[model samples]
Target: MPKPSSISEKPHRSNTSEESCAQRPHQIVIVGGGIAGLEIASNLPKRTGRTSIAVTLIDREPAYVWKPMLHTIAAGTSDVSQQETSYVAQARNRRFVFEPGELKGIDRQGRKVYLSPTEIAGRRVLPERAIDYDTLILAIGSAANDFGTPGVREHCLMIDSRSQAMNFNREVMARILETVTARNTLNIAVVGGGATGVELAAELIQLADVSAYYGAAGLRDQINVTLIESGPNLLGAFPDRVAIAARGRLEELGVTVLTGARVVAAEADCFRLADGRQVSAELKVWAAGVKGADACAKFEGLELTRNNQIVVTPTLQTTVDSRIFAVGDCSSLPVGDAGKPLPPAAQVAHQQASHLIRHLPRWLRGKELPTFTFRDFGSIVSLGGYGAYGSLGQFGLFTGGFLRGRVAQLGHILLYRSYQSQLHGFWRGGLIWLADMINSRVRPRIRIPD
Candidate 1:
């Protein structure tokens, strides 16, 4: 890997249309089309003074989905299509170029990003290529970290992406339809008491209920869900009372909750605990912790943390290269008086994107950048339709109190709506929400993909 140097050198100019004139537009290439990357691409100013700003977004997936809702999609409770925004369409409408490819490598010296060949059904459709950029931003997001546990790669299913979520849904639906006899039970074990695990456990219960309603008889009775947390409580990020409330709700809904039960290994049919006991399950999901993509470590020679996250300054610029920036789950920057790394959450990504949207144009015009400050708006975890809980951290001044029940649930829904409004503008985004409401009334509540 080449070592990163000063970002003063301009990239080699190509005879592309954007550079055909005497003065070329300042090229900005953003890798990853997740929450932060897409927002930055959509909202960035198209021009900085007399020079035009050319932005390009690259990603492996063709469409963008709100990753926080993957659990609902995995349980077949929500339609992925309703939430998906095509990269092609978004780029066209937002005045940016979209390239469908994964980041292969970066040439910091040359200011070029190399992308891997794009494939469809195991065949390559586009050859590997490189794109030059005056500024590069990485927001590829994070993935589940198994902590090197044995058999986890083969035995456990992870819902880090849309395809993975759909794959889990298919297997779950197949198992639900197979439970014809009361003697056979579909046992599921979810490892991780974080928001993903707890929410998925509740969604699974709802999945059983929806399955039975759709003529898959006795699914509720024939399904067993066990939520195992290595910590003493679920939703460890939330307040203790919220965690207690979530645990209580899951228990009341027939979920087996196990706290402080560390998983030693995942076998073909069960999760072996460190205490010499095993929790048997036919389907297993691992959502315990997240780390930046392992592939991120291979990107150029940028500084990385032990978890593979790119290290960035408080301004969101990479420590090694001033022209390169990283945000979202893929980047690590410590803030606050405690100097703790920011938590991996949607709000963090959104705030970072908004920061860049405000500061990048000023940066282009050669102005000093300000440090990015994150305002804590608190966190909310929704357990499908069972209930919701939230704590307003710095935002409590406006709310006047913590939230729960329908009010907290409304807050959860509004977060996604606000995201859509930011991405699609208010009018089109409102139409999208209205369309979803109409679809919910007419379409089947559950999706059993073929």
Candidate 2:
């Protein structure tokens, strides 16, 4: 078996004599082991008696971390390792092949995907390689869209991935620790009114408290968190009441809520707003928006939306190629009369993954594929330990009522737990959850990197 971080360029060949070249298994390659990709890979059948199938999952990272919890990871209040699911272990248990590499390019006509060499410390770990596939599924997900803002690319930190989150955590920890001697305010300005920005603001306040508990006493008082949103309010995706509650909750926690504040540019020490006012801060985070990853632009003739997301049909197949499918935040699937695409969210990805899991076998057997219909179960936002709020949909509520406080918090947590259960099976998933609960009791929740 290959190591967790290793990738083999050679084609997977069967050792049995009965499996001849004429009867080669169908090759299914999934790129990006994110919420959708990993879920589909874990649930898809390993093989069918009449028609054999081979599954290979490729990801840039060796382990998968719930993307929704990235705010906590960036705040240094969560143990990252405890939450990550190793792709190698998952692949081994689920009967699929795992490869670690970044998708650099794609060849639609040749049915090949190009991967960049994996490197660590400026040294080569694995050479660049290509993988063949009879059918391809792209779930590469979204990245922080800077919207061509000046200095944003250079001055702001984005928590789009695990590495980016860790980098921000390190800087935050260092800056907070320095406050002990400087006796100065540790100012942080977060751009965006969405869940990412709101959650991050709340998590940073909690982080300040945790830091004080560890050693940096009075850090909470010395920290100033400002959440700037161009929109009229935060959590715009939810109902007005929910947004009002979220804004009120955040303001109560000492977070400066700035609505209708459009940031025109980012500088080393401050953000220049549209109204000529500047918000000073030592750390700036841009979680204002997300777009399909940059790599999607180089997908070799695949049709893409204005935001660089691959265009897919209702069946989740690429517009130009039936054999290639796209899902999650990376695919642009139009809905309703406006033809607006679905927002990039974990629930959207989860539903799409579930759709493919149930229908991919039919596709493999040369049957018709069903159109994917996304069911929005509503939105939930966690305000650290302060509170949580949600506008529950019919699926979430019996008679349709809003969720608040601990109920909403539990719902937010269960969202992640459900995905883990889907990927690791209920028995092991329950055990994993139990272990985490036990560990939380004995271990420190705050993570300080050495």
Candidate 3:
């Protein structure tokens, strides 16, 4: 790995005819190719005048997956291999440079970022590179927070990414088959009563049904799913009625929704609860909490919150430097009503990306940047094939039940589609949607053997 160059010595501006032509187009480097990062890249204005801007998107993964759909993958309902979008191809079509590299560190003083070298199949591919930028956006997203519990990092699987979720799905299916063949009981424990954990628990029930359909006899009867949470109630962020209804729905599916149960230690095949209860399982999933990625904390000279989220003002600019902007799970922007940092969710990230797309060009041209105000579009958590539950309206006065689940699911699907529309025009998005529908009809509902 080569050392990164100092930002001070790096060329900040060029003095060619192009440089003198209008305001030199600023170089915008965006980290992370997730929903937020990709949206920002796709919505960037094309270079029309002397002040053109270049956008480079960086991510460690080769493709992008709609993260909210990870639960579906874990439940064997969706195949990640077919659903993933190649970032390289999308970047080319969207007119941005895509760099597949893990972000190592950032030098705000020099306005440059150090990217780790990328390797594939034990062969070195892309060497370490330093990207200089006039404006930087950090949308690296967040990972599952384990809360430093024992054996969590080693034993439990987190469905935070496509590969991880797919691997978990394979492991789960294999375990189901093994238990059935041996006539042994199958227990799957999910830690975190939050939306992801609840949805995954529900999906597992549906997956059991699929397993039975595939000739796995007595699979549904033998399978047991447990959802653990430290809070007194599930979906703590939502209305009490919604949480209570969700618990009942989960229990109806034979999933054990254990609230106020804090997992203190995770073993290879079981987790010990704070109440000294031992719950053994064939598989364990940790989806309890989330914090910013490890790389975000390593960013030097940036003001971050206690959770390592970049501290940003109302304008979404980092407190340490105005030239750098942060969004998504990696940022902690002040919220309006709550007087706290905005919650990290897809909706907030989407809103922030849309705002940046509209105002970043103005900021580059020396115009004042507009303050980003987040709209509280309430959350909807899918309850597998059964239904969905969540609240809507300005103050969440509009409570929804099972039917709202379908609507919530559709809304979630549209969120990703909206991102697709930004990347590919509406016509292209329509074409992609049609192709997906056709492929779904022709292909097997579940993935074939790897």
Candidate 4:
């Protein structure tokens, strides 16, 4: 309703405490509070006299926003306030201690992790500290891998975090306003044919349509979206027909799809391809691939992949240490006798977290950990109003077929809600869902970032 504020403003902390547990309970330290870490902390049994462990979750951010929803955030179609899970509040409610800091290094022999100083509002908020653990879990998640492309770090935008998504929305809004003022078109280039890139391109068109409906009619016809992919088709992981359907859907929505296009370099306003094609745009987004956080490479003597993902065993334990476990996109563990690591998806992390929940406590009790397995279940690709498509099974024993239109979209929403319900109790989750539905009706359809 008012002019949007900058998301770069220091995040406000809430319900935070710096004190450690008084009792000498077995310390279970969790680094990185993404989906896996949050679920693991929430699902842990409440501390009673019976239990003798204290769970501590550490992360750089004060809140956790679902990574999959970043596209909608970038498009200004969703407000983050209702979605972001506050780490401090979650810790208080779930009986875990929350520490905000970036991982500096790990001492494998000492069973401790060093955290860099945490700064807020241009001042030292939390000083450098060390936390010890009987068992440690690393679920720090992954970041966008520019893959040595020139000028990419400076020129390309990535929607990998809440702040990044908010910044992207601001950029999109600024571009739209400029286009409206100039009565000209604004071209956007999105690299990668993966789900993020495809979903983002589609969501931007929806943003244009929403802007047109709400007094930005002059800018509706001025937004041009170009999707570039190095692969042969969109959604390369999906079946050929499904990928074709996704590409066709985007094309039907006026998106320019360039398949088999390799981006060799990124410039301020243009990207040079391997085939000598240079694509010009006002804004460029890189969402092709991901690697573990930069700090993963500094984990003492931990084994890591070329992309910096920690090498882990089938039980999700790091190859170098059994006490330390990695999950989500940051850890590379083999799957299905394929000699390849598990796919980077939230579902994989979710299932893995659930498996750890069953085994982690016992693992601390001298029980041997069992090998972890994953179920494919299926993959769903959203195309906004154009439609959604998904396959039921490609990896697991369960076989499934393609789902289209509302059915697929409904599945997408339901899956997200179920995740919320899993974290919060059914009653509270239902109330939160109702609140979101009500907010959609009461608030503006398109919201600028803060």
Candidate 5:
């Protein structure tokens, strides 16, 4: 992240029809184009003849990729180019302004946000600019929190973003190649037994199988993966049966599962456990917890939680400034768990974003914003190509049931497709799904990077 730039410049005012755009309450800036931000911008009207609201979405990256698919990218099972959607095209088609820059700070009193210059490949792309908005929405999602453990950040890789996940894939492939050439065993340690870690461990095994198919036979026997969970069970959020099944599946795939194994610290090529045991590995990954970006602390005066997540009310409005809102992994809103903040999940953010599409227009009319309620549709944890488990509950309905196998796996894929459908509409989303299917059968194994 860059330092906060000057806020002397103001955003351009809207000069559209008076009925469609308001002059004073003109710009509505949305920071972060993750699942939440993109959905809101796509659903919100670009121009309602009856009102004025100029929408602007700013993010450090120029594209959006579903966060859950990051593990696949990390395992070399998916391509980043195929998974990413161009933000500029989305903005142009959806009727919003797209600004590419990293958010550094916010001027709450002045109603403006400071965006630092955008850089790519060590080259400057977009210069710093100030975006003034009567209403600002922060959807800047989270990153993997290492809990300040010694050597965690220095030694472990995380799959919290597209780039990091891709980097992990490259590293894994490079290590596998090294082991193949040296005729040695490759050890891998995935910390935090959460959904991401579990999925990643399983996917790595599947990736090894694919590598064998691509002329790297005997790679599987040379690769060893360990999944470490501090909790008593994997997928602690899911039912015990789901956890048992997931652990069983991983074990069947030859993954070493370590429960109640808390990592006190990470050293180069090894992790020190709380019980004084050490787990050695050639590669380590941290997927333990979620926390807001450290850069968000520079937002100046907004109320934030210990994790640096913006503290928001039930309506997703920032506690300190009603004009500013937050959702997704970046928000800490007291919605459930005895006034504790809601879990930072994709579903939570999706529901909140949907609620605003209906309520934002009312907000512009000076009417009361309706409260939001989150209904969990359960969860699905896919164990690579072997199987998936968990439960699915209907949205706003009275039906729920446990699921497994292909149905569960398809359910996971459907959840991602639902988001794509929401963004690109049904026709395009359907086509993309078809294309993915075709590519799966027709495309050969991915080529590992050097």
Candidate 6:
């Protein structure tokens, strides 16, 4: 292995389009190429008059995937290839730079971030390089929290990223086929009753139906799905009635909903409950909880919460440094409800991104920084394509049954489209939407490789 480059070192030139840009303008480095980071790069008031800030968006992956749709990918309802936006392409179009590298460490005093070199097939493709920034924005998302359970890291699957979701989808299909061929029962254990867990459980049920239709035998009856929640009810964040209804729906689908059951240990083939009960499962999915990216907590001199999230003030600036702002799942900011930190949801991230876009330009010009107040617009958890349940605004809990569920589905689809509109202009977004609609009708529902 070669020695890593320092933060001040320049990257070796390649034929890549990102490297072809001649000017090395004043920098505003945005970490994590997720929704929040991409939005910030896209909407950063294109450097006017005396103010010119060249935005450099960095991430481990080369492309940006809308994470809210990961559950759909796990269900084989959405193809990752179709949904992902190439960060390099987007940066070129939007007049920014895109660096595909994993964040290794940060030097706040030096205003620089050390990035690990990217490699492929045991060959170094991109050398370690760093870009100096006047302003640093951390939008790196959270990861599935294992809670230090034994064998979880070695055995369970987490649906945090697009690749993980796709891998799980493939594993699920393969498991269904294997069980069908062997004419044996296949059990799935989902740990966590939050929105992602509940939504994925519902989607897995749908996938079973799809598999049975596509000639995967014994799937309809032999498939056993179990949901384990530490709380007394699923969707604990929602109203009691909503939680009750969701649990009822899960039970109706023949899923074993185990409430107030915590997994103390996990093995390759099974998990041990806190109460000394053992659940046998061929495949395990852990959606239990989330913590900020491990790298975020490692940033030098940054204040972090108990959950390893960056401690940010009301204006979303890091407690140790005003030049650094942390948002999305990586930041811990005060919430109105429960007087605690808000849960890491796509809604909160979208709100933060929008808020920052509105006020960041003013702050960049030595003006007043806007305080971020997160308004609870409420949340809607999709129960696969069957239905959705949750509340809207301050209104009482609303349940979408059948036709209304489709409306909710449209709303969910529009949420990502709205993000796309922010990245690309509305006119271009409309064109993309039309193309996607036409392609959806023509293409197969699931991806098949030749």
TM-score of each candidate structure, all chains considered together:
0.94, 0.93, 0.91, 0.92, 0.92, 0.89
Q: lDDT per residue, candidate 4, 231-340, as tens digits?
A: 88889888776788898899988999999999999998888999999998889999998899888987988888988998888888877666678988899987665688
lDDT per residue (tens digit) for residues 309-405 in model 2: 9888888888877778899999999988898898899999999999888877766666777788888788899998999999766474463568899
Q: Supply the global lDDT for candidate 2.
A: 0.87
* Residue-wise C-alpha lDDT for candidate 5, range 88-186, written one tens digit per residue: 999888888889888878887666799888888899877888887777889999988888899998899998877788789889889988998998999
Error of 1 at 406 (Å): 0.5
What lDDT is reached at residue 379 by model 6?
Answer: 67
Query: What lDDT, from 0 to 1, does candidate 1 have?
Result: 0.87
Cα lDDT tens digits, model 3, 104-165, are: 88876567899989999989899999997777899999888988898999999998877788
- Backbone clash count, each prediction separately: 0, 0, 3, 0, 5, 0
404, model 1: CA deviation in Å? 0.7
Q: C-alpha displacement of 413 in model 2, angstroms?
A: 1.5
Q: Give model 2's clash tally.
A: 0
Distance from true location, Cα of 336 in model 2, Å: 1.8
- What stretches of model 4 exceed 4 Å from their correct place? 1-23, 47-49, 395-398
lDDT of 2 at 165: 88
Q: Say which prediction, candidate 1 or candidate 3, comes out ahead on TM-score.
A: 1
Candidate 3 error regions (>4 Å): 1-24, 47-50, 395-405
**lDDT to native, each model:** 0.87, 0.87, 0.80, 0.84, 0.84, 0.79
In Å, residue 167's CA in model 3 sits off its true spot by 2.4
Model 5 score (lDDT): 0.84
